[model samples]
Target: MIVDANVRFEALSALLGTKITSLSGGNPWKAAPALSVDDFFIQLILNKKTSYAEEFFIDEKEFFDPGYDFDFTNLSDSAACMRGNEPYVRPKGWYRMALKVRGKYLDGDAWLGTNGWRSYSVPGEWPVSYHGTGLEGARGIIRTHYKAGDGQQFGRGIYSTPKLNEAEKYCKTFKSKFTGKTYKVIMQNRIKPEKRQIIGNYWLIPVLAGTSAEEEKRIAESSIRPYGVLIKEM
Candidate 1:
């Protein structure tokens, strides 16, 4: 399917939080917390009132097996504790909360199927991490197995990088991998960087699926106009 760059940028921009400046000379970016405030509160309550250790129980067969040293009495006590407090533990509401958030940020016309959701530009299923030595290392990985079909949509995982040059390096490497192919990079506004081991601005880079290598190359090289926020496309 032909994904519209402008439409995708609009959707992604709306979901981004406020941009944060980095002290490390990286691009400004935004971040979505791993857990929302509601989720945090629920976890805090669970930690305070519940004994997670009590939820585990050893099988009688394992306890009796001579090959393994078993603490049968302790296991029994833990199981008993879990059963005794079963009524107090509340059901987790994180999944429901996530669904609500997805609905709020996703486009209205996006298809929400039983297995997953999909829009013209975004995939309901998140992409796997592109594990490599550096941003440019993606070229070697893509050259090995990346495939492009006429109708199949492709998504690149979002990541934070302090340097715009690093992101450009990735773009250059990715484009070279698909030399003579057509693809479109839907660039989004840089978001506040998450204060993690790696600190930088977060950006989503999506390439549209193409029919042929030349078409894919064209798509990859084509410039995307900025939407609500200005973004540099390579």
Candidate 2:
């Protein structure tokens, strides 16, 4: 007896208490009744009654429900990090996410004064002040004391001497390391003492390069939505 693929799929969906449209439309199946979709399919296989339809249906338990149990606390922490308005603690879990290659080197160079002296700023174009992106904003704070000809003070300069050839080379290397590279990242939210305040947020500090393709794919699929300075890849 030949059964229509769609008809069989709909029967499976009904048995699992999920919408037939959801199954046919390729959407993630909602939590079904006590009997999971996988269990239902497995029962059919054991009964030896689904042999005719088995050829068209592949057991896709993983696709239907990736078994990773997400920690609600961790998800809350992630949400808090994105908000940037309160102090949050990092929950221990690796989240999969993507980051777009916006530019090379988090820091940028800026001419400090009319005397041709250049200074290093967290974001070269923007003033190195407190930004509201939680931990990232706190990390951008620079600690340095600069003096001019007479009696003056400023932030740290980019180079002590006028020789910028070596500095340019370093910049190129830094750019090469991150630019045009894959955007996939596995990261965790962290908290650290910044000056006087303890700030927390997801950082790119310990970027995880997964050992295998499966691991990488899992990370990419499960990561949190990128926010703040991290742009989502289109």
Candidate 3:
């Protein structure tokens, strides 16, 4: 679920309070302060499930899916405020499959751009405008580590790549873990892989969570940040 972006090495450092020295900037290439999850918000995500489902498996987005969309659950006019292509604002009806998900969070290819900046031009880099995905992409990834299987590509038993035949494979696995779990997930876009296009394809995201510094580094290594401007830009 880690959405790939040119997060300045400092952007995360500011929040985690890790004293990382800058290789290029020398004076801490990271942003001024550390990042804090206190004020951060969660953009939930769930593809339309053919059957009943409480949650959907979040997988890794490839180089074609745009990974910079925003989440708009707390907004007053979430529907209206999120209408059209504003920074972080998705085009109206972009998430047409949003028939279910209870509106807890915006489902599908959502993202996390602080302050809802969704313009073609990003803060540090990112020249292309992020028209969709929204915040569900970011939260979908974070949730995987704590509750569901492993993040994006590390598919345990629950979530997996588009190669799988059934998307609800985890309903039974975790069902026994949590009794009364009478729900299963279905990739509404299954059978016809083209339906997945309704969510866009481009860019990859690598989510980094947990209290382990070593674990976070491991996540960073295997991440395919085709959109990275910091390293590539360097």
Please write out the lDDT profile of model 2 over residues 1-234, one tens digit for every residue. 122234333433322223333333343323322333323322321121222332233233322322322322233333322112233232223122212212212321121111121232222121111111111112121112223345554332111111112111211111112233221111121111121221121121111332343443233222211111111111
Which has the higher TM-score value, candidate number 1 or candidate number 3? 3
Give the per-residue lDDT digits (tens) of candidate 3, residues 120-143: 432222111221111233223222
Candidate 1 wrong stretches, greater than 4 Å: 1-159, 172-194, 197-234
RMSD of every candidate to native, in Å, equals 24.5, 23.2, 18.3
Q: Please give the lDDT score for candidate 2.
A: 0.23
Cα displacement (angstroms), candidate 2, residue 187, comes to: 16
Q: Order the candidates by TM-score, highest first — what do you get?
A: 3, 1, 2
TM-score of each predicted structure versus truth: 0.18, 0.15, 0.19
Q: Write candidate 1's Cα lDDT for 119-161 as tens digits.
A: 2223332211111112233332221222233433234322323
Candidate 3 least-lDDT 10 residues: 225-234
lDDT of 3 at 23: 33
Clashes per candidate, residues 3 or more apart or on different chains:
17, 1, 33
Q: Lowest-lDDT window of 10 residues in candidate 1? A: 88-97
